[model samples]
Target: MKHQTSQLEFSRPLQVDRVPRLGSVEKLSAEPKELKALAKRMKLPALHALSAELRATPWRGGGLKVEGHLTADIEQVSVISLEAFRETVSLPVSRYFLPAGAVNDNDQEDDADPISNGWVDLGEVVAEILALDLDPYPRKPGEAFEEHVEIEAEPKPESPFAVLARRKGD
Candidate 1:
């Protein structure tokens, strides 16, 4: 599909309290300019494509659970080669958000965050996940780090006088 470039920011706000009990599924794709903005925000060389399929389910009577898969096409400079190369990132998304001040069951909620102003910004969530998954030290496939090691110099031969002195002492 053709995407017209625009100056609009990337944003998708979902009201946590309005989530249906049966759950809702949504698919999101970033526009060219949105992608560019996100790339700059994340300090990436380039972001060619960004998309996600998310499902939001009401949970614990007041909390929301969001599950999805994220896919992105990005460019990064390889640490080994110092050249820009393309990479495709496909990762699962799972996040739970509880209403601010709401009680959450202790277990299985380690990843939970508090909903702000009754809403969750899905676009920012997508961008944050993408940023978290980027490789800190990118490298091309089949490339291995080879460290430069210096060779040790040979030790000088012991003096003949030293050996003679040792023999005399013996």
Candidate 2:
């Protein structure tokens, strides 16, 4: 009888995140009060949608910029730009071997699912959304500002080991 063996290699395609960008810039003609109200309604949903889309993407590092200009008629239109790092997080391929006992009597074979076993979590995504010239168009920009505010806790006192190490003549 003759014996033969086969080898299998697994590769997973890398998924890239799509960053949002400003498509066009235009001006609006309305009163300051009316434009403020309109801008608020228009930008809030778009910002939220962009945030959700960013959360869904595989890549987590990027920054967003929003710029707005007011026209003589007191109309406001904003442009949003996004820049992403070209680097990618590459995942290594894994190899597996099957034992003789694991093979079926009918010449069947069992293979392990690579993804199911080797899943890894990179980390949570952090993004900074900034709006330019916000002093004039305060209403719309401030709506989403509170969500991004970070309240950091004060540092705790060092332990005895740290304190002793810092002491002179250790």
TM-score list, all predictions: 0.79, 0.14
Candidate 2 stretches with Cα past 4 Å from truth are: 1-147, 168-170
Which structure among the candidates has the greatest lDDT?
1
RMSD of 1: 6.5
* Candidate 2 lDDT over residue span 1-170, tens digit each: 22121210111121222223432222222334433443354343222111111122211122221123222121233222222111111122222222234334464433421222212111111111122322333332323333455789899878988887779545
> What TM-score quantifies how close candidate 1 is to the native fold?
0.79
Worst 10 residues of 1 by lDDT: 1-10
Per TM-score, the best of the predicted structures is 1
- Candidate 2 residue 26 Cα shift, in angstroms, is 43
